[model samples]
Target: MTIIRQRLNELRRRAFAGRTGEIELFRSMLGAGGVLFLHGPGGIGKSALLDVLADVAGTASADPIRIDGRDVPPVPGSLQARSGSGRTVLLLDTYELLAPIDDWVREEFLPALPADAVVVIAARRPPSSRWLADPAWRELVRVVALRNLAPHDGRAYLAG
Candidate 1:
């Protein structure tokens, strides 16, 4: 990697302020098995949370596979192939772009994962009805609503 890219990543990590509760919650989810669904409006920090959690997953010995919905074609096969055969910490970003195959993902793809695998889905939209309607999913899923950072946290981010 270029020196600039490395520096940028370092800065990003350093600039990640606040979210202590969210980070703690994320750490708690790492050791256990289940899904974490983070949703909110634009620029609410869902993606940033996922990025930080990916690093946390690495420290926990879970291989993190990050797939941006915007980068891949809107096909289940493409997503499936990149999702690490259900053995890794799957970070699915920009889920709005992958909304077309939401059912396939929830019904077919997620079920195939290992019990120990961790899947974190970040999106602006709330999970579909099926996710909440299904009793099984209700047990395995945790929905965290991301809100705007506090004034102090925002200021800290800027100051960093």
Candidate 2:
């Protein structure tokens, strides 16, 4: 079953449409030790982009560690352990679920990562004030607003 799912996901990823600019921005920041926060309404393709970004990380010779926020515990230790020290790309999806530990993730967990780690966050809403208010984060964080796909891209994705 897992093998089948992996194959299916690979096919879908190949057919994934649009967001070329977003993908490029993510690629530029890869291994740059910055936060790429992708926010939009539910089902807006943030998770899908992360999937592609994970593959991008692989091609760049970086190991990608993806953790869906819903599956993460509140403990920072657990996340640290799962991510490990070698991960160059850390993808966090469904980030709203991690609200309970948001501050810790921004303040503690992220700060502890290796200098070159790239963290991509997919959430339903824009980042909270804490993330934006911090002066130090201003230079390190890049927020990308995800809008709906264009008509042609939508058609291509659906037809694929």
Candidate 3:
């Protein structure tokens, strides 16, 4: 297996830690979803975690497309042309740069998403709106806040 897959497996072991509930959440999203958001402040492990997730998706034979917010396309329709059929995962890092939720949803976020793939948005915060605040989006959008690793966990992670 590739190093990414190995590292992702390790992350699954450490982060999920026998928690089927959490595993199922990710699994369900991979199978079918509305949207999954991993939001946290800078320097948080958000990017690292996203890397692991993308790795897993690749291992599962999914095509992972990574887009830096700085280079995002200007229009949403362009997304459909870019992402074809199959399991196409669209990941946007540093998504906070795309403000005004409506524009993002229409232009960059929505169109780029393939019908049969998982869409992961790693941002500092969710959109500030009533629709985003709704419980459905809240459930679909898993916000994993960054937390300090315990000394032991840190040491173990490094050793791994």
Candidate 4:
């Protein structure tokens, strides 16, 4: 996994501005089996983080099922077929694109994921009330917010 580590370091340099917080966030999310939501404003590197995660997972011999929430598929069956593969890390990029999130979460993600899968989700905002209010849904998901990078870090990321 040395190459993966190197790639992560590079991604961190270019994407998160060498900020240790984002790296720590990624490390914590790695191998974690549950729903993970990363919410942040536009231009704050949310998509870049997802790309870094996918790159790292891609290099580790781990199967990655990256679904761009912007271009979400029509059928849940296709999603299931893709993510059910072994040792898969499924990333739902820009999750807010598919709002009314409960329907998508229930009909697609929850069913598509394997018991041991790691799910990473990046969103512009948290899900709607019906989703947030559900105890069962709350039980299964971990929410993380991405604040803007510190000034020095922001400069570093922008330098690239």
Give the top-scoring candidate (lDDT): 2
RMSD of each: 1.8, 2.0, 4.9, 4.3
Better of 2 and 4 by TM-score: 2
Error of 3 at 1 (Å): 14
List the candidate 3 regions with Cα displacement exceeding 4 Å: 1-24, 73-81, 100-102, 106-116, 134-139
lDDT tens string, model 2, 1-160? 4698789778979789999998898888874678999999998899889889988888898889999978878667767888755657899999888888899999989898888889999999889988989998988999989999999999999998
- Candidate 4, residues 116-136: lDDT per residue as tens digits? 567777878865666568787
| lDDT order of candidates, top first | 2, 1, 4, 3
Quote the RMSD, in angstroms, for model 2: 2.0
The residue-by-residue lDDT of candidate 3 on 25-101, one tens digit each, is: 56677777556666777776666666666666777777777765666654554444555466767777777765534
User: Of the pair 1 and 4, which is ahead by TM-score?
Assistant: 1
lDDT accuracy of residue 54 in candidate 4: 75
Q: Where is the poorest 10-residue window by lDDT in model 2?
A: 78-87
The 0-to-1 C-alpha lDDT of every candidate, in the order given, reads 0.85, 0.87, 0.62, 0.69
- Clash list (residue pairs), candidate 4: none
C-alpha lDDT of residue 60 in model 3:
75
- For each candidate, how many residue pairs have backbone atoms clashing (under 3 Å)? 0, 0, 1, 0
Stronger candidate by TM-score (2 vs 3): 2
| Model 2 ranges off by over 4 Å | 1-6
Prediction 2 global C-alpha lDDT: 0.87
Ranking by TM-score: 2, 1, 4, 3
